[model samples]
Target: MLIFTSVTWLDLCLASAAVYLVKQLSGKKNPAPYPPGPPGWPLVGNIADIPHNKAWLTLAKWGKKYGDILHVKVPGRHIIVLNSVKAAMELLDKKSSIYSDRPVFAMGGELVGWKDGLAFLSYGDRFRYYRKNIHRVIGSRTAVNVYEPSEEIEVRRFLKRVFAQPEQLDAHIRHTAGAIILRISYGYEVKDNNDPFVDLVGRAMHQFSQANDPSAFMVNIMPWLANVPEWFPGAGFKSLAREWRQTLKETVDAPYKFAKDQIGAGIAPMSYISNLLKGRTLSAEEDHMVKWSALSLYAGGADTTVSTIYSIFLAMTLYPDVQKKAQAEIDAVVGTDRLPSFADRDSLPYIEALVKESLRWNVVAPTGIVHCVSEDDIYDGYYIPKGSMIMPNIWSMLNDPQTYANPSQFNPERFLDNDGRGPEREPRTISFGFGRRICPGMSTHRSIHLADASIWISAVMSLAVFDISKIVENGVEQTPEVDFSSGLVRRTLSHPEPFKCSIKPRSAKAIELIQQDVNY
Candidate 1:
């Protein structure tokens, strides 16, 4: 080692002083304090502390240590997680103009071409145009009414599949949800369970979810890695993205092209696409928006419904009394000769309670697609910088003991008041989401037509037709361990697991009604 003189030592001290001054100056713009959070390391911040599994629960735990509005930084990014319904609504709803934008999802949005989707689009003129057009087709409750015949036919098919192969309940649910969305979006019939469109679309979404996992790829944090050549060493993510991009292209293009061809040939069915095509001539840009917006409908619809219905199955297995109560209510209103329809929903109060409870108990999207702050602002006396990711901890809000007494228990009675007629509380307020960014399909408005979500309709139909009970092996009934997936969206993680349950037709009349399928 070389010896340093007083002159060299003085130079080093001056350099260190200059760096400190620069750091202080950089923080002056947003000198307001960040929301309370766990201690973080220098430079890396709380990167390692970011939970990889069930992050929504982890964030809630952090919220207790920090405050309701917890702040954490990951490298150059800022993340604000709202742990309570109050905070979520204040920021995501009351201040939606600034909080409705989405963060840049490099893997899911950019590389896979999902940025074109309305769900992932940035806040701008294009976003508004896409949203407006999507609403025109699927915005109203009356619009859903137009599809009730098809929905009923599909539900009947679902009932038949369940009756035949109850062991494949998950597959049947997925198929029904997929078929309904496919038919509604493009008038495409899902040919059996192995339709190529279903498979391809499933693969594309699987890849998107994989990429969506915060830890799945580093390129999400360091977007520059997306630019690396496919052949570059350790650049396999690029190839993965390309493969998924191709699948996504085919998923959006195949059905859309067919819909266009049918429309041109004058044999078009009354689908969302056909309805859109019949009206006014669309410019190239408008056409592009419609194509991708329709795809967003498919992306948003099926998986959440399938996950919740699976939760309902699990709930029925665990809570037999709840199942019995719902069945009793359904039987009293709908009778055994006919299956339940949308009209029967209001009449069966217990079934409605069960549906609401299913959503609140095991939320499909624990932390909904995170919103981004479009400008710097202060919330609860803490500074939230522009472009910060705002995560609404839906799980915490739904599970909070203060909100729902005995929150861990799966009790539908929480929603029923003394009369057991009108609801004391509404879970949909927390389940679908908050503010302007709320799920379009789940929102309610009396001014518009009575549009209902497919999930809600499917849940009522399933409960109406089948009697769910625990699976017995070797003379012992087994309770399924509630092992849900830790993905951004919750689902049963693994297949061929021990979550066995049996579903049977409640009566011969029910089976007969299901078999007598009506043509749409």
Candidate 2:
């Protein structure tokens, strides 16, 4: 009996040793190799160090410590942050073929129905189809021509609102920009802030931002947890996921139904939905495509553009000299006798500089959308494994001390030439994004920004006089220090943050031109 027991024990020991050998061999076969970063704890990884508010600011500091290509591990995931323009361009742009795919999130894609959205769609035929359709409506010269009338009307309306109630400048910026995109994309107008369509889109966008957050759901990191039945009372995340999915579906479908109703009644205007629906039948895939595309436009066009305009206002108030220079250029070129038009953009160099500077100073999407690697690749002799998530750290790139002297200072002169000509400034760092994932809205955004900035500078001479120094805290007045918060997008950190300034017409001619020329 003792001999038999010894033989059985030996067999068990041999089985355990073989298992260990296999695991070691497998690990060696698929070794994870990327740049160096602080070691992460088991399970949670480096999630605790990721700042919820100012993530980019923290990321920039980390970049300073660990070179440009830093590896970050998040339980079962690998994130590579490209901190410089050179690295971003090399990996994201030059090797875009394998870098265009976005990381898959079960909640955002499967539950929230983002699989069809152009921004989140995987690189494939469906994505190609969506891009082709988008380009047809908003990409090329023909689309720009088609959008001209609406753009003009909206800008005029924006100026009129600014002239009538300067206090509501923020709301005006939101409305004018939102309305034009709405009109052009869906043949709808934002009649008021309370508009259901506008409110629904806003709510949906907020939810999307939250859902996209890595920490928003544990199931995102450990998706197997989702398999637990929703009826189980203790399934905390399951319940929340259900609610988010429901809200997303409603938000996405509401505008879609409106578009469909309009199409069915033959009242369909020459908008994106109408154009696409003209010759196409709604297949299941196409339905997904349409809904997601609509959601993308509503969310992407509204939030980021509005945030940029807000930053512009904040910058103008904080940096009076920058505002003064922009106004001076507008006055000299277009004069106070006429409203600035797209054609005058070439001549108004200073206004152009101010726009570029505003974008740089307080970047809208600071960390930028994440990109995923499709295959294993090498960069500078470092192994970038397949399926590593890429973060183009825009904050680091934009604030590179070597590229922009006094990087923290809000100076438009950095982008301008000595002759006062706004030279085409190449990004010493990547801000928008890299490669094929570069913002398709670049041209559209440039035109809108230039037109809006020029008008604001010309009409509101007091923009230069606005003082952001006064802060009211606990019913007491004091001067507030300039501070900003970081996130996927950066926002002004300090509050009671109202700028105090008197806005007056730059000239009598300016008032007359604004009052007469503005069609709204």
Per-prediction TM-score, please?
A: 0.90, 0.83
> Candidate 2 lDDT (Cα, whole model)?
0.65
What is the lDDT for 299 in model 2? Answer: 63
Candidate RMSDs in order: 6.5, 8.2
Give the Å shift of residue 55 in candidate 2.
1.6
Give the residue spans of candidate 1 off by over 4 A: 1-29, 419-424, 444-452, 487-498
lDDT of 1: 0.76
lDDT of 2 by residue, 48-166 (tens): 67766767777788888988888887655788988888898889878989999988766666666555567788988877677666656666555656666666667666666677787
How close to the true structure is residue 491 of candidate 1, measured as C-alpha lDDT?
25
Total colliding residue pairs, candidate 1: 3
Q: What is the RMSD of candidate 1?
A: 6.5
Instruction: Return the lDDT, model 1, position 19.
Output: 52
